[model samples]
Target: MSGLPTVDDVRAARERLAPYVRRTPTYAHDAIAFKLELLQVTGSFKVRGAFNAVLQLPPEQHARGVVAVSAGNHGLAVAHVGKTLGIRATVAMPESAPARTVERMRADGAEVMLLPTVAEAFALAEERRAQGQTLIHPYDDPRVMAGQGTIGFELLEDVPDLETLVISVGGGGLIAGIATVVKALRPRVRIYGVETAGADTMRQALDAGEPVTLPAITSIATTLGAPYVSPATFDAAQRLLEDVFVVSDAQAIEGMLAAQEALSVLPEPAAACGYAAVLAGLVPRPHRGTLAILLCGGNVSIDDLVRWRSTLTV
Candidate 1:
């Protein structure tokens, strides 16, 4: 099967998911325009992929319901899917998952199981699978990847002359999917993948030339702290991306601060990962064409954010 995604697939996803998802906004930053994917339905880009995965499931399975494991965004994504499909949902989330995020998932009507941490959440998800629950993966699924590719399509539509597209990697769903479309449609565009310094499973995976699970994840940016990068995403990224990079949680904080200072936007740590690349000098500012970054989400607690602001170097 071809690893590339087409414009038609994105168009179909956009149409089928129109009522359920948000088209979001595209912001122009002098030289570049960003898709502002953080403005998507669930306040995260994952909603696009989650809805796509749910829609792809067999009708019976959709009716049977779905389950997922996430640090936060993916769980919220699945919760959004459940709400749209009127399906029962059980999301396994780490106990350390942000309180605001946990409440948001509940608001979306997902039955959330809070494990000790992300590791335990995965174990709980496997246990749920044995109970006949359909798993709507956050990543590592073609349907999900195709769904996220829609973001790439939107970017292309907004900035036909885009020169660079930088994305933050968790399980690599966002970048892998973006690369799938952009590399095929705009082969000249540079694809840059960013990961948190300590939680850089995807970066490590690329360096080793294969997927490798980190023994543990440690980062203040909880949402982008997936302990492992799936082989499927690694393969696609290795083949399509220009480079894989890493940044510190402090850098992610800087990214968030940059959005607030420069654009007056409130961005979550996960959504801010792309700008982390710019701060770390991993990707340069394009002087001619667009240098777009995928802002993945915006669901931070005001109190926690206030605290981050006090200590952030931005």
Candidate 2:
């Protein structure tokens, strides 16, 4: 795999995953546009990467099974893909992950191990790799980033006049892939990344000129709570991304509520970061054309939604 996924890589991934993943739609609300990746198969864009990575593996490797580490969405996506491809999957998730997310992964037939933290989950996943399981990293792998890049390909096709693309960053696979494709296809179109203030991995990585691990991730947007950005993702962001912005947890909740009110969708806090940036005016708007905000995932449970709703009134 290359250090960065090329446009050809994304195109190939699109062809390979055409039948399995949805070409999720984009819609304009007010002056801003939204890419509804929350409507994807596993209720998140993570499935695109999951399917791409799993399908790329040799058929013989399938027998050894696959392992992954996730706060929630990535594990759920991997579990869903493993079931569809008939491979056994074991996911190491943080013990603090939402119960609904844990239950969803279990329902999809993955053996879910609850680790004490995200770092520990990754450590356990590495150990499982040493034990012969194929490790499908959530965001660090090129194949996975190529898969996520397919969304950028779709965006250009669906919204040819797009002037800027705003995306939420976690471990950076999603934005890395999208930025690579978008920049290649339309260099003039700016790409921006958003993260919760407490979990600003990409911002810190860019500021330091290298990937840095945070001592702790304290954001309510647990899905965007990657402790460190991977080298590939960090490199991609530096080369392609125009700017990175941080929003408070409360602003993210407000963005979630705003999306639900305007588009009738309740995005998880991580997915809401892009919208949060817009709503908070943390990033500059396009002067001449439409800005596309990626609504990356919508995996929050009804109970969680109610709790988030209460925060809005407070």
Highest lDDT among the candidates is held by which one? 2
Q: Write candidate 2's Cα lDDT for 1-314 as tens digits.
A: 43778889999999999989999999888978899999999899999999999999998789999999887889999999988988999999889887888888888899999988777888999999998899998898989999999999989987888898999999999999999899998999999999998899999999999999999888878899888999999998888988999988888888888999999998999998889888877778888978999999998876886776676552
- Mind giving the per-residue lDDT tens digits that candidate 1 earns over 1-314? 12434556766776767777777777876555656777778778898888887887788887678889987788888988898789989999878777888888899899999988666888888888888788877777777877887887778888888998888888887787878788888888988888887788888988888888888777767777777877778887888888877877778888888877767777888778788677677897776788887787887766877787687655
In model 2, the Cα lDDT at residue 194 comes to: 96
Error of 1 at 212 (Å): 1.2
What is the C-alpha local distance difference test score of each model?
0.80, 0.90
Looking at candidate 1, what is the lDDT of residue 150?
80
Scanning candidate 2 in windows of ten residues, the lowest lDDT window is 305-314
Taking all chains together, each candidate's TM-score versus the true structure is: 0.92, 0.96
